[model samples]
Structure formats: C-alpha cells, structure tokens
Target: MLKVTPNPPVTEPASITDPTSPYECPDSKKFNEAAERALDYYLGPPTARIMAAPYCPNRLYMTNPKSSNESLLVDASETLGSANVMLNDFAALLEGTHRKTLLGIAQIVMLGELAVNQVLDNLVPTE
Candidate 1:
C-alpha cells in the first residue's frame, strides 16, 4: 500500500521547528522594490506555459521582441515580452486597473542604465 505524508502545521513566528521560513512582512516600498517576485507569486510564474513577462508594460507596443530562452535572460525577457504583446488588445490594462509589475522591472533596468551612463560619463570626461 502507498503511504501519503501529512503537511506540517504553520507557525506564526518562523524558526527551525516552523514549517515556513521567516519572511519580511509587506512594506509600503515593497511594490517598487519587489515587483517581479510579487508578480510571479500572483501570475503563477512565467513557466513554459506562460512564456515571458512584459519588459515595458507602460508602452503600447504593436509587437514585442524575443529573448533567449535561458535563466540569465529572464529579466531581459520581461521587456521584450511587453513589445511582443499587442497593446491595442489590452486597452483596459493600459487604463491602469492592473499593476504592470513586469513593466516596472523594465523601468528599473532603464534607471540602472541611466546610472551606468552617468558613471561612464564622469570617467570619460576626467583626463
């Protein structure tokens, strides 16, 4: 006969004995900081079934670009995914009812690029 295992009870304060690991409670800034993880939790992750998350959720792209199917390119896929999805078809989403968490990731990348440019600009100008 096959045996089934029962799940352990969850504890309020996580410790070695607790079934779940301790995690920081949601904070006001968590949305901006952990958008991707939040989206993965909600949208059930972009597995082989879902493909990729939008890289530019803010833009109304006619078509998105494709990235390599690799873990290293997961962040890159988010932006290209946005370009791939038809913006016209998701007018309601564009109106801003749903959170564009994936696009937020792309925006973060843009911000990082700006920072890098500033650093490079400073270095090149210095003799």
Candidate 2:
C-alpha cells in the first residue's frame, strides 16, 4: 500500500505583501495601513504603548534609587537607549528588578501571567 502525501496549501501573494516589495497589500490596502500602525507602535510615539497622544516622558525617566540598591534583571542601564528602555520604564523595574523594595513587582508578575494565559488560551480554548 502506498502512502498518500497531502499537497501544500498555496498562499495568494496577490492578497499578501512581499517583504521586499514595500507595503503592497492586494487586499484593501488595509494590510499596508496595519503594518504601518504596528511599526509606529514600536518605533513612533507612545513607544511604551502606555502613553497618551502627546507622549510626554514620565517619572520613569528619572533616576530611581532602587536602581542603585538592587541589580536589574536586565541590567543594560550602562548602555541606555530606546531598545533597553522598559516597556514603561518604571513598569519593568517594578516587575523585573530583583530589588525587594521596588513597587509593582507583583503587578508585573500578574501581568506576565495574564499574557502567558492569553497565549495558552489561544492555543487551547475552552469548548
């Protein structure tokens, strides 16, 4: 008896954007718009996804003495810039730093748990 192999599904490039072709969405041009939104969310304003429109820098930008007291889980403070900048500076410090005195470590852990739950929920939804 011969085993039958299933054919690979074909994706319509006409409906998809070619990575090299620069935002060409054959659909309704919505994909292009969405791609730009995603990029802007990461690279443009409200970078933390927590700030309002004006995007004024928050207290997190200020020096936290806790930084001196305890080692951060991701200690890249020596190399400061946007990438290392926390999701919401204080937000991560509250959650990631091993510093016992810092606020919101519990909250950060809760949020992380919720995010993980969301992923798992997507994979195994209740019937």
Candidate 3:
C-alpha cells in the first residue's frame, strides 16, 4: 500500500537551561512581564479611536447580519461544489510541478466539502 498523506517529523523538547550552570536560569519575572506585554499588544483594542466613518468612501460594502443556518449551509455547499469543480478544472490545465501543487489544493477543497457535507448530513434527518 502507498502512503499519500504527509506525516510530520517527531521532535524532542530542548532544555532551556542547564541546572549546574550559573546565570540564574533566566528570570521568570522578566519572562512573565514580556509574555504579559505580548498578550496585551495582541489582545488590546485599537489605541487610535475612529469616532466616525469616512465622509465619502469609494465603495460601500455590507453583509447580511441575519443569515439563517440552513441558508448559510446551502450557500457553503454551493460554494464548495463550485470551488471543487473550478479547482479540478484549473488543476487539469496545469503541467509538471504546478499540477501537483493544484492537486494538493484540490485535496484541501475536497476535505472542506467533506466537512460541510458531514454537517449537512447530521443536521438534516433522512426519511
């Protein structure tokens, strides 16, 4: 049997510091402060407050705030089907290395299709 799926290489954890050696084994307080600062940087809201929208935007965009679950699922299914078909068609047109790359992308699309199909299947009861 041939293995098509890729497997990640196993890795062993590295020691941060040697016990016998000096240098205080790196201060936890400093590490905690750095980690806290990083968390604050990422999680903190925008520092610059935008009080109002642009007076005249080039293009206005709006999304459906009240999309139903069924409608969303149907849309997802249709989009997935279209994407899979387009990807397969696009992949067929490619040659050599590009073909393999596109095929890998198609595999990802197929996985998404599978996931969506599974959700739909579970949500809708069969007669």
Best by TM-score: 3
Top candidate, metric lDDT: 3
The lDDT, on a scale of 0 to 1, for candidate 3 is 0.74
What's the lDDT for residue 97 in model 2? 56
Evaluated at residue 4, the lDDT of candidate 2 is: 100
Please provide TM-scores, in order, for all candidate models, with all chains considered together: 0.23, 0.21, 0.51
Models sorted by lDDT, best on top: 3, 2, 1
Which digits, one per residue and each the tens of the lDDT, describe model 3 over residues 1-127? 9899879866532324445533343575467778888887668664522333445544455336587676777788888888989989998998999999988888898889888878877888668
lDDT digits (tens) for residues 1-127 of candidate 1: 8769878976554434444634344352355458766766677644733455545565574334453334224444454445434432353365453437545555565666555555555545545
Clashing pairs in 1: 54-78, 55-78, 55-79, 63-83, 64-83, 64-84
- Model 3 TM-score is 0.51
lDDT, candidates in the order shown = 0.50, 0.53, 0.74
Number of the candidate with higher lDDT, 1 or 2: 2
lDDT of 3 at 33: 74
